[model samples]
Target: MAAVIFLVAAAAGGGSAVWFGAQGWGKAANQSPPVLPPATAEVTRQTLTATSEYDGELGYGVATTTTNRLTGTITGLPDVGDVIKRGQSLYSVDGDPVILLYGELPAYRTLKEGDEGPDVEQLERNLEELGYDGFTVDDEFTWRTAAAVEEWQDDLGLAETGTVELGRVAFLPESRRIDGLEVELGAAATPGQPVLSHTSTAKAVTVQLEPSDLADVKTGAEVEVELPDGKRVPAKITELSTEVQAGSGQQEEASTVVIAVAELSGDKAIEAAAGYDQAAVDLIVTTGERKDVLTVPVTALLALAEGGYGLEVVAGGTTSYVKVDTGLFADGRVEVSGAGIDEGTVVGIPE
Candidate 1:
């Protein structure tokens, strides 16, 4: 006669614990005929990818505020969406242009013949880029560099003092599109006052995730962005930053968040996002993948009482347990390999 076998079914990848009590017949001298399993599934081979999706905004990315270091009335302001490049007039103060230069260091002091520092070198680089040459682009600001600056000032109709005065120029890392004007045309332009806000012209997706969610994400990681029109485009993370957000109420606690900026890489993304300036999108990042491997539903795995894990192979009206080794677990399927476990092998599943 058949006898009952108690089995503990634990899903792979730390799934919940399940206990199953069933009747079974084994091929032995005194055992009865075999009993069929209630349910069965076949082992199959396919690629599986583990991914996480987050809400993102598709736009020109973050905006940086351009503060005024000059003192005068705001005579001219660029219209919103105006792109300012190197050697161009970003805005005007008292009818004089505050030139835009490409550099990382801000103009902190007046750069003259005797000043020697990184800011001087930055100015010299911009002067050389604007076609005013003859001076070495170094940390030292010599008379020759002042001569080039005089020439540049002459072109902009400024005083030919041969000394670059503070507040005469604004330094940015690159060309930027005007995002918004902070002050009106007639507003007073005082030192340290914000003038306008700008951003890069390239299309990007911005995602804010919890700090713990950023463990697998890094700069230069490739990801897919799903646009509003159901188009998928490839992108790469270009920047990452962390910020602490203060709580609004006393009962709330402050939280740290990671900001991820991903720039769109190909023409497909540009074309798909042509009509919209900003839209909601989804950022999909793949964390793990496995290709061409035998897999089974996680529920099919049985925790053996002896040790390790096993699967009940159902064949020809009889069932036998085959111990198997497991690998990556993804999408409710576990990568499995062992003796007698091949593609099309029917494995028993709990009803």
Candidate 2:
């Protein structure tokens, strides 16, 4: 079998490119070159990744406000980006350390020996990990629990009272990166006043998608993020949710948007985002993909006279058309296969 060739061409046939069939190629082989600007594309092998970009922002994830639980003057505070770890002062009120403790329980009442609940268990757990001994970590606040609390209090140069005062500490999980100071230093620290805010130190991107786009943005789905400086980084969707956003009034429409968080994986995106605490990034969410397929310029497909589509192969100034089976169409290209088509086949694109 001699090498077959095609001259692809199309400008108005169903708005798609047409190919000179093998018979047509044979006819054009001995003829003069067609009077048209030469425009052609090779039969290239590539994976067509169907992706869509959405507006996104880079930061340390969602921010939640930390409130002051004591009545005093705010004396000291940590700056934004400061990591308040376990057993450290989140903020000082009247010179007393409002310590950071790890727990899920919200400090409601003063935890003393007589108290018996999840808050006690939470305190005991933190104490157990912070080198306090001789106490069982459970919901019951026994004397041993009070002993541990007093030891911790004494270590912090506070009163060695057996009770853990509600304002003496703030409960958080592990550690947090201070995001903002909600209340200024020297301000009166009133109960329930927003003292500061914080978020996890990890870098992440958040995207809000229209309801129609939610299907492709699933939790755990892998994605790519383009930073403000044009750096691309691979990321994974760590969270996804659909919630109704309340409208201004009862007459207004309550819109539902898909909220997703994508965790960035490399230092490139991070470095590009330096000095930007919260900045916009573009998200390329791959919605569909096909690998190792024979593809050509979507315009290369000719709505053939014989029916279906074809591509024109050009060889030695001769052009012929070969009918092709078309598949996925994306990015101005279409997946194609046929009897005499392979990668490297130069197909013409009609101007």
Candidate 3:
């Protein structure tokens, strides 16, 4: 039985099996590194620097709202977006004086009401031109005035409350009236109806910063704004709010901030203002420049068993792991600031 077992084992080639396997493994290990080409890499130098970005908008530096003081239908006036200077006459009210109900009429009221002067006429003309068709220029609030008021209220969707509210007059739409806000036209508003809106006069860029980066922001930091049209506007940081906004996904809670008072040079200012209202703002507050410094491909810098970093430097056909002090890392190259590693040194990547 022992002889028969030996014959079967020999046929199976017991000794040859281990030897062939070892030989194949050795050949594979030897040729692996060279067979697959060493990853070709380039080295560069790092420099210390700062960069800035302005994430704000470009618009008229000042935004303002004009309101309708009297309840009336809109009449003749410049179309929305007409630029006006201070003290420029914009819109006028009609000549029909609105019946101002006073709980107690004063002795002076009779004289003032009857005084039909140019001021009242001018007010009427202005109001008529401004779309206030509720009153005639006869300088008195008559039945026709009431009819016009009701008609105006119907057009503006306001309740037929004839008594004017001064607040309603202050909140008129200067340009295109939006639907979401409280100050809407075509609504029957009384005296004091808020019809106008005002926002930031100047255009600015708004951006949200990650919480980790919030500390880096401050007022008066120099910033650069890049427009989608490839235009860059330089500006100083004007404000930074500490309010943190929650992110929707993948992003952490961040703070949205606005930067104003941008310094746009020449026609670039006009170019920036053209589409800045809806433009995406890229704010850069850090400035960086490329400089010549000792740098190596980041992969070469390995964490050594000891402290510091290590790299395989090939010299005279011999490779040695040399320790290196790394500096700033940029452009895929680590700034190497140590001895033993020089420029153009052929380094071997680990097996």
Best by TM-score: 1
CA lDDT of 8 in candidate 3?
36
Best by lDDT: 1
The global C-alpha lDDT for each of the candidates, from Candidate 1 onward, is 0.84, 0.80, 0.46
Which residues of candidate 1, in runs, are more than 4 Å off?
A: 1-41, 302-309, 348-351
By lDDT: ranked, best first = 1, 2, 3
- Between prediction 1 and prediction 2, the one with superior TM-score is 1
RMSD, every candidate, angstroms: 4.8, 5.6, 17.3
List of clashing residue pairs for candidate 1: none
**Count of residue pairs whose backbone atoms collide, per candidate:** 0, 17, 59
C-alpha TM-scores of all predictions: 0.85, 0.76, 0.46
Model 2, 206-238: lDDT tens digits are: 888888887788878889988877778888898
Between prediction 2 and prediction 3, which has the larger TM-score? Answer: 2
Candidate 2 ranges with C-alpha deviation above 4 Å: 1-37, 108-110, 114-121, 138-140, 241-252, 267-269, 275-278, 303-310, 313-325, 329-331
Stronger candidate by lDDT (2 vs 3): 2
User: At residue 315, what lDDT does model 3 achieve?
Assistant: 49
Error of 1 at 350 (Å): 4.3
